[model samples]
Target: MATVTESAPSQAGTEKYIPFETSVNYEKVAVGGAFENGRLESSWYKYASYLPHNVPGKQPPLEEFQHQDVGLRADPEKKALLNAPGAVFDEITPAIGTEVHNLQLSSLTSQQRDELALLAAERGVVVFKGQDFADIGKDRQREFGAHFGPLHVHQMGGQVKGYPELLPVYRDFTAGAVDNEIKNNVSSIKWHSDMSYEM
Candidate 1:
């Protein structure tokens, strides 16, 4: 189980609260949004809404937006790709290969591995594509993952032979087919959460 550490109270009697830490690359948090424009503006009503006016003429401090901590795991390749001249999505394919080639998982320092694990925990989902894990079989994957915590067993019919963690993510291409509308035309795919309504 993951543990969250809270900040201790200050000596001056100030209540110190620790905010939630996330693993998702904080720098990429709001990647293409309206807030991209470098401006800090909010409505008067919005500011007043959060304040308590009952205390005579006392006013609350205006809430300032804090940038999310991008964490210590720096990806210079990713950064370069992001800033590359005339770089498009198609160009990113080769860049990803270069990044993967440079990533030595076993050779990572303890602090770096911890940071990665923390990132995975915070993100809830971390995806790696085109990874050649043929040498590391399903059993090895299970054994390595067991170091974290006890693994959960599949509850329904869709369980793998040996590895329960290896859940099948199937998409039936022939599900929504009409007379002429082939499998390729069907855009509606089955969307299900990994574990639904289970706490």
Candidate 2:
């Protein structure tokens, strides 16, 4: 009689991400509904087109990802949360006592905002960089953050004029014409996780 062997079943919750040589994975990225066809068929093409020409030297043409069907699928609960309205918003409030710093907010879109809010809730304290606070203003920032819960005020001075919840993150400075003072210098910046020092 011939010997028979059976293949092991695929593991649950395994996700197949498109393999790329670069450190970043660019496959199966959940772009908006606009590009669901698995091709570069959206306004995003304009931004992607610049990468190759802008960088000097030979570059690879954009190719369809192989092994696209290899990953384990998302469970119903995970899919529901990802697609549900306000699910991401619900996550922001839970991050109150956690230590999170230096988040890249500009890279995230409206959809990602929901996911980020969820991350903030679970992780506690999310800091964002490259955010243009000019349009948001002090009041709006405070108000938006307050949706999660009551805002906490800083112990030392640095609160915004009307909104005490908005901290100014102050630094001591000295008057000197030749040397750069603390106010002018961006170096020696110590960014601690919010509320870590509070008693």
User: How many steric overlaps are in each model, in order?
Assistant: 0, 6
Name the runs in model 2 displaced over 4 angstroms: 1-114, 121-128, 172-199
Clashes of 2: 6
Strongest candidate by TM-score: 1
- lDDT of candidates 1 onward, in order: 0.37, 0.39
Q: Mind giving the per-residue lDDT tens digits that candidate 1 earns over 1-199?
A: 1223455544774433333322222223333422223321212122212212122232233234543333344342334423334322221121121122334343334344445454444444334333444335566556555444455554543434445454443222223223235446456233566545443
Instruction: Look at candidate 1 and give me any clashing residue pairs.
Output: none
For residue 67, give model 1's deviation from the true position in Å.
29
Write candidate 2's Cα lDDT for 1-199 as tens digits.
0113354565885533332232222233325424434433335432332121122243233333333111123231233334444322222222242222333333334344444455444455544434555345556566555544456665554455555556653221121222353447766343457645552
10 residues in a row with least lDDT, candidate 1 = 89-98
Residue pairs in clash, model 2: 14-72, 16-71, 91-118, 91-121, 95-121, 95-124
Worst 10 residues of 2 by lDDT: 68-77
